[model samples]
Target: MKRSPMKPGKPLVRTPFKRTSPMPSTGMLSVQSHQRTAPKRKAGLKSKGPVSTPIRRAARGQDCTLRLTVCNFDPDTTVLCHSNYLADGKGMGLKAPDTAAAFGCSACHDVLDGRRPRPADLSLAGLEAAFRAAVSHTHEILRSMGLLDAAPAAIQPTLEHP
Candidate 1:
């Protein structure tokens, strides 16, 4: 009778496998490499454009206004999370204006952006309301920090006399 020292379903010997590149030996550049080296066109004209990087940068170290049940409340993860509603200018492949943003931690941002599920206690309308409230609170914070202008006033049209 003989006994085996090797464990069951285990290989007693192993060998390293070498992988070969699919590219030709002539050093022809790959499509991906060529694309990577190509100059990229910057999106959106910054001159008189809607781009507001300063406002986004101001969100750093700010408290999460969208304090959802899933909120992390970690200042490091906070940022100016833009509103996803179309009324706020959010659309396909487009973000809302920075003014319509709220300071949100990663978790709360995920929930607000629909990347994570909403809390059990909150309905769709409730979530929307909470996000709106957070946006308003963040606006006040930004205004206090001098990052935003005062809220615009309603314009009334005057009747002209004959």
Candidate 2:
């Protein structure tokens, strides 16, 4: 240990670093590649571009489809809540796709997300059934809004001129 001259006993802020070997090198830099590369994704996981942002944004101001006893039914609080079911592609650190989502209020979202307790009369099976129904209802709304691919074609009005 090196002592400070001023204090006579206190050590300096940092100990001097000693190098035992020269810095390692890979090779000469190539003209084709100089930038760092991203880490590889885990096996079986693949990104197909970003998730549906338009559908998510369209959820704003929509009615709560879950309509659980805990549902606030506030349009201002309505948003697209992804499915919690594993069959819907939900997994740890991964959410279900927007197509599998439903329009839900903050209260319903909390119940589905397990942040809040479900209704006393509602069982796990009942909750699951309700979520499935809500998903269907949400899909209907999306279809009516022409957001989903399964939406029916709009009828064009023709004018009869004299």
Q: Who wins the lDDT comparison? A: 2
- The Cα local distance difference test for each model comes to 0.86, 0.88
Candidate 1's TM-score: 0.65
Work out the TM-score per prediction: 0.65, 0.62
RMSD to native for every prediction? Answer: 11.5, 13.2
| lDDT string, candidate 1, 42-86, tens digits | 876345554659889998999999999998879999988998889
lDDT of 1: 0.86
lDDT by residue for model 2 (1-162), tens: 697458776766765884455446679664544545999888757776656588999988999999999888799999899998899999987889998999999999999999999889999999999999999999988888888979557999999999
**TM-score of predicted structure 2:** 0.62
